[model samples]
Target: MNKTYDVVIIGGGLLGCTSAYYLCKNTDLNVALIERGMLGMQTSSLAASLVTRGRATRPLIDLCVETFEAVSELEDLLGDKLDFNHVGSMHVAQSVESATAIAKQTEMLRQMGDHPVELTIDQAREKAPWLSIDQADYIVFNPKDGFIDPYRLCAAYMQGAKASGNLDVYQSTEVLELVKDGAKVTTIKTDQGDFVADQIVVAAGPWINTLLQPLGSGAAMAPVRSHYWITATDPLYPVTSPVVILPEAKAYARPEVGGLLFGLRDQVSKWAHPTDLPNSLQGFSFDEDYEGWTALEEAVEPFLEVCPSIGKVDIHHYISGPSGYTPDGKHVIGKAPHLSNVFLASGCCGAGVAISGGVGQSIHDLVTGQTPRIDLTDFAPDRFGDFDPYDEAFLTQCAASRSQKKAG
Candidate 1:
């Protein structure tokens, strides 16, 4: 790294890399990004990578829509195709309550000028015969929804930033601490060396709190276990299959290769601290939590009526990783309270890849002293105030609350 720089961003996940890409492309500031491990191979690479556009709020909807456009143009920006699949996505509701929620979501999408069609069980079954839709009360389909190769997307941003001549990326470099001078962060002490910068943005996923704890700006984000399973290749669910979210089932699936990538939110969220995790994701997972499959089983059992073959499909792989989440189930963004020139963008709630572009742009704008494109009222970094980063009882309660929100 250079002796000093205009900006230094910690963590090379999707948020950091995308922020770097936009910062370099849109500003004249000298920037450097440091990552403790290989870029995008942590929570980002392990993500299901479902790029859906419907959410409970307008800002989130706009965020997802913006990400869609950004991910689409990445190939032109980086000169490489990211294997983006624009098949579509649908939220399948199996009960009266979930169907009501779907109607609300569909109306919200329509109000935002996005077309989302609500299909009856018969219509949904006709569109995808493999769907066990007899038990589904309603299904909402958004044609613009899709998925992408997340790792390639990260590489695309990194490549674009590197070619900009004003950005440098450091991998396998661990940031030891952020040295604050009065109200400002003046130096970043890393394993390689100390580098001073005018500003610092921490997009360190689950490790964000660990960095902030020392600065007294710690927020209430926690690392919760998230996992998805890939089924053995089945001719019924091919690559063209639209992403399906079963709200009543608390499960979602996207076409993966020729099979299906299945995921579920646990009823009681599992929490992990940064100290308990390895620096890299190379050999990290929750395989030791064998009983966790019970939650997955409870969530997916309702899908059997829609697809009786679900029971026979072999478990291809249980893809597991920890994702950052907050008590209110919204991402933590904006300037860090009481810290001069320190901004944070984490707590993605497992949808980091989908909203990454918008998030990155927001961080870039904030760092450059410009107003963010979207409202940040719901995602303020200090909105919930500081909390004990290592308090399992309180953090676990917050994590469990997130699970309740998703299922409710």
Candidate 2:
């Protein structure tokens, strides 16, 4: 007889571990977190880990704010240090149009009860003396924004959930299929064996499509690869440099341990899914083709002009990984429409690490038949309209438009 669990969570990235942590903490359910490979070794560990609270939409903004608050106190909750640096963050606008957008964002934030301060270019430069403010017209500063160690945060959740003695975490175990009887999932078939469960939560990140494809849900989840660059630590670089974003360029950077991590939003064509376990330390060969490298350098030029020392810095490394994205660019976080007992928490785009805690909490509420802490109608699995050819074309165009604006 296969061992049965009250709940079996698929994908042990930040989303999965977080869900496990919350379920164990708040419920009496027997939980098992299954990972295809090492825990948090996939997209979660490879994430840029910058935590922020601003977005193009209201639902995401609200979720991000809530998650930022939870992550700020994560160490206290876990009784362990997560190395969360409250260095604050700023979004710089290089043009009048972008500056106007920043102003609108500031107003929206204010309406949301957030304290987003609008700063002139001079004020921004004063706050961060290393920044070049010549071309920048305006900036939006949020003091509560910062970065965290994704690995440490994942470990903290796993450790705490394990200590609860109600959770079983199985790393390197691949879930092969979701066994369902009628509308309820009854068992999770894995490469090693099978485990029965009353409820299944899929927070598989980029690998979500692969797992869901077998169940004919792949079209709803697609993976996009994004890359980031790192620089050797410099004495002149402030450790408190805010998580800076050049919205016009779609580039962002933040201070990290002994160095600075940065990345642009240029995405190449999608590649086939990896068959092996995910590795975070794998380095990309930018030497083969300099398109992405050139783009990153160009985007960083404005900031580098403000700090000449930054241009002289050597490239420490290149980090690349897949981020799950929906056709609509919103997360799919409620129940799978065709399957009642299976819940989805995937397709977080690039914001999973920032909002994993809140996503987990919301999933837990759904499992217990309670209203989610945040409104999830916008992220529902069934919100994509009909999957017809016309709808697909429209979605593709919208996604392209959004990507162009984001990568500009």
Candidate 3:
């Protein structure tokens, strides 16, 4: 590899890979992506690939819509077919509070180009016979929303970036430290070797704080453990079924393989520093709150009402992993605070897959001195100033924000 490049993106998750792809394709600058482990095997691969277009904020909605457009063209760009299921999605509100929230979101979403069809009980049931719409007072359905195979999408971006011939990827290449001179990054010391870059983007998922701290910049997001369960095959639910998000239940479910995949937003929050995590991705020792089963039971009860067969379905796997979340339930994007030629695209806050393409393009536009399509002032890296990840008070806030539904 060359001693230096025009741009060096840290981490090889979905954000890094997409950013690299866009940076390489859009600009004449040389791009190099460095990953500590095999690419697309961390949070990006493990993310619940839910791509819902109905968001509460205008910026989020714009980003999601942009991401959908980018993802729709991935197959042609990479010369590969990705498993992007455009089966649409539904968000049901069972309680009065949730119903009111849904109504407000629906009105705001319409202003942002998302036409959410408010479905009646019978209409919802007709759309999905498996839905127990008896308890749902309101349902907002977005036909444009869907899910994708996150790993495949990540791989496609990597492959597309490589096909550019100007982009280089270094797998299993750990960045030991980032040596900066004054305001700009000058050298990247890695276990394998040392390299240089004029502009650097830190897109590492959970390990973002570690990389930023060396440059006197740190992430305020807290690393929290998130998990989802896969159930045994249920013939009723197919891949074409719409993904259901139950805000009252603090859970969401969709068809996975031949069964259902469901996740819960437990009230209890477990936080940990990424540097303290186990080294191996296959055997990472993070907190897996089995007690979440209590919350999980309550979370899935609504689905049980619609599909009683779900009660009989045995769980196949309880997948658990870490996700960086901010206290205000927003992502941290844009340039790093007090740093030049350094940009940050971390703190996904659990919607990394949905917004990766927009984040990548926004970062590219920022680095190339072009105006970004969406105004990201709300997602400024230093929005909340410096915060300690180990602070219990801050982490407690982050945990609560994990499932705090966003409604403008």
Candidate 4:
């Protein structure tokens, strides 16, 4: 069978789903979202779902703000609240270097007109009883930071797009090839059938290169392994505790129903060789034999000082996922330099949930020939100079970006 639509978006994860929502809400373009599996079932679902506003960069911070605003907007549009809670965030600095970083981060927030409150150790301890403030030198708290269930957020975007009456989502549809005519992608060969569209957006996350390789185009991102551990429920983690960012520890924690969810940046981050990754994440995962215990042992030492409660609870579960990471730890958005009709929106560096709304709006703007509300030069897909996504050295570079992430 053959199908046609005004636009066909590949990868129905965070970027694709949210892009569909913005398009349907703002335009009349008939859109079809293609996914190899269920929506938001991959990397998007693996996020800790902390939508913090204090990012390392201003552009990224602005993008974070857009997501915060998006939650409110979506609520008004659907008359249904998302899983977002304004429980706030605490940034603890355990060393001079980490303290300086927090100082710069707080200054950036103030420069952006956001009032991030500087807290005394006592105040931070009162707010986050589980975190050891005695180990902290500087503490900054932002009341607007919060976390949402990524699955629910993605579902809300899908529902919002469906409500537009102009969007159709094809689940379990795998895009096999992107057949180009002249300079444009004319035919998308999927397992189900062929989809012809005027424009194609490859928001395919880590698997983006698989679909774009034949076109001589690729986003400068590789699949980097990201994982987290959850502790058993304990009174130490109050249900409404603020999200915590510990740069010195290279870890972060957030409240989860009297329990706590935390993640750490191991010195050596794992990058799946592209060939090892599959379109569907159902039965496939990184082939680490130790199941991250080796890495966890190396990474969890610093985080324990701040949150000693981790020692008291049995780890309820562990989850790991691959997020598209770039060599520069920035986003890869905007149109492909060679492929005029394709827009790349990957390389989020595990911040996909925090910046999805801005990514969606930018994609919609470029697709509809409207000006992007914010400058997008930093997110241009081809910014890192041309490089093969499969190159070993380049892949390691991408992994390093995620491994050294200090900001939560």
Candidate 5:
């Protein structure tokens, strides 16, 4: 007989793990997490794991603050340390125009009750002597932003969910198809076998399209390649420093265990599946392309000017991964319009890690036919008007155009 579960969640990343944890701990549902490969080995592990509470909008700022608070105490709840470093974050603006924008953003943060300390070029240099403050006109520092070990956090959630005895996690299990009875998902067909479920949550990240295309829910999503680099550390460059973002340069860097990790947004963004995720783990012959590194180098040039010593830092290889994005910058979270028992949690862009906790709680509430903790009307999958395969090309073009203007 096929195994029966009250809820079957696809994708074992942070979203899936948190959903399982919340459902198993708070509800009476029997849950199972299905992953195509090892848990947290995909985009979840590749995430920069940045937690920031500063945003231009009120709702997004609230969400970030809520998530940061939740993740800060995760270790206390799980009885294991999450290895999060609350080094805060600094946003540096290169030009006068960018400085004005930063000033506006700082005001927005203040309105959101987060008073980010403004830093002059000299003050920023004093704080991080390795940065090139001469290239930047202004900097806004937020003390609440920080980074976390994404793999450890995912593992913690998985372990906690498993300990509840109400959850079963199937790693290396790929969902082949969704068996639907009219407008409801009745079973999930996987490589191992089939499992009947009362509810299904699709949080498959980049692979979400493949799983949902057949459902014909008029939902659209796009995947973009993102790359980051790590620099060898020295005693002078301590990990206590905050994560830094150079908005004018279209790059960001954060302090890691042994060094500083950085990445940039490039012009040539591709949209295709390489049959495997890009990285060392999959034994894929991947190397950092010229355009990506060039962007990173240009973005951090000002920082290096203020902190000239960092220019001599050893390079720690580059990383490239895909981020599933929606037309708008917000995530798509809600029940499928055509299927009553089917739910989706994709289109996160790069914000998935920060919002997974709240997303999990929202998914749990949605599955139980209760009101979500937040007003998710703006993130509904049905918001996309008439989606089609060719729509991806248009969406990708639009995203590329927007990025180009942003970088220009």
Candidate 6:
């Protein structure tokens, strides 16, 4: 293998793979992607894949719009199905605050071509018998929202990048350091020997700072613990049932075959610098708080308001992993703060899968000297200036962003 290339990407997760895909498809630059473990199996796969297009901000909404368009473009260009279920999304509000927000969102969404349908309590239950949201005072539905298989989708991006014959993937090759010279990063010192590239893109998710900290810089995002619960096969989670979002409950649920897949927001946060973060997550502990069980019990009490279902359902699995979140709940993309050759794509804000396309394509545009299709002003990597990402206060601010997110 050559030690030099036009571009070298660190991390084989969804962001890195997507960046490689667009670069290979849109440019002729030879590229290499390095991963510590298998591609896309880390935090990328652990996420509860929810593609909710309607967002709170216009720019975010536009990013979500570009995501759907990119999904179509990927399928059309590769002739491979992505299987993104556009099974609609139901936004349920149990409090006056949430109901007011939902009403406003529905009104705003209608102007943006969203044919949102207002659903009554009985109607919401009819759509998702597995859920008991009689406590909900407001409900709205958008048919364009849905979920996807995270692993398969990540694989597709990697495979498509390889189809160009210009991309090489090195799985299980852990990146050790970024050897910088002057203001540019010239060599990537990995466990599998050093490689050089004219340009480098760091999409290493939570581990991004491990390479940047030595350079006296870091991405302004915290790796918060994101987890979900999976239930055994049951007839209640019908495939036709739309994904339900409960903001006040800080929960969301979608069907997983005959079973149910639900994720709740943890008020508590987990934080660690990449240096302190464990390399393996197979048996890592996230149940630090004793409140988890009680929160689950209290949260499930509402589902039991209409049916005695969720309380008795046997949980088959629990998925927990890192998701990079910013203090302002936005993604951080664009050039690395002070590095001339390094580009960053971090701070997914719990919507990495949902907004991968826009982020990926924007990274491609930046590296190729072409203009990005979306406005990157709000997503500048260096917007926060210099701050200690490992600082407890900073991580807490980042945790606030995750706490505010209720959708999958």
lDDT of 6 by residue, 24-53 (tens): 988899999999898987788877999887
Per-candidate alpha-carbon RMSD to the true structure: 2.1, 3.6, 2.5, 1.6, 3.4, 2.6
- Give candidate 4 regions above 4 Å deviation: none
Candidate 6 residue 70 C-alpha distance from true site, Å:
3.0
Better of 5 and 6 by lDDT: 6
Judge candidate 4 at residue 28 and give its lDDT.
Answer: 93
Give candidate 1 regions above 4 Å deviation: 290-295, 405-408
Candidate 1, residues 382-407, lDDT tens digits: the string is: 78765677788757865875576542
lDDT scores for all predictions?
A: 0.80, 0.72, 0.78, 0.86, 0.71, 0.81
Which consecutive 10 residues in model 6 have the weakest lDDT in total? 289-298
In the range 162-184, model 2's lDDT, one tens digit per residue, is 76649988888888887677767
Candidate 5 weakest lDDT stretch, 10 residues: 278-287
The full ranking of all candidates by lDDT, starting with the best, is: 4, 6, 1, 3, 2, 5
lDDT of 4 at 187: 92
Residue-by-residue lDDT tens digits, candidate 5, 1-408: 798998999999887887787677678788989998888888888887787766545555555565665565566677776766877788887788777866776788887687699888777756555576556677788887788788887887787677665888898898998878888888899999999998898888777766676776634556666667777877655778787777665666777776878766665555544234432234332344543466555445644554566578777767766776666666678887687888888766677777777777788789888987677877788886667633656457525632442210
Tens-digit lDDT string for candidate 4 (156-257):
888888987599899999999999877788899999999999888888888888888768888998999888888889888887889999887889889887
**Clash pairs detected, candidate 1:** 132-306
lDDT of 3 by residue, 1-408 (tens): 636898999999999988987787778898889998888898887777899877767787777777777776777776666867877888888889888877776787787677789888787766555666566778888888889888888888777777764887898999888887788778888888998988899898888877777667866787787778888877666767788887766778788887888777656656776678654456563545453465466456645666676678788877767788888878888888768888888888888889888888888898888988888988888888876656678767877778564321
lDDT of 4: 0.86
Better of 1 and 5 by lDDT: 1
User: For every model shown, what is its TM-score relative to the native structure?
Assistant: 0.94, 0.87, 0.92, 0.96, 0.87, 0.91
Q: Give the per-residue Cα lDDT of candidate 3 at 355.
A: 87
- Tell me model 2's lDDT, rounded to 2 decimals: 0.72
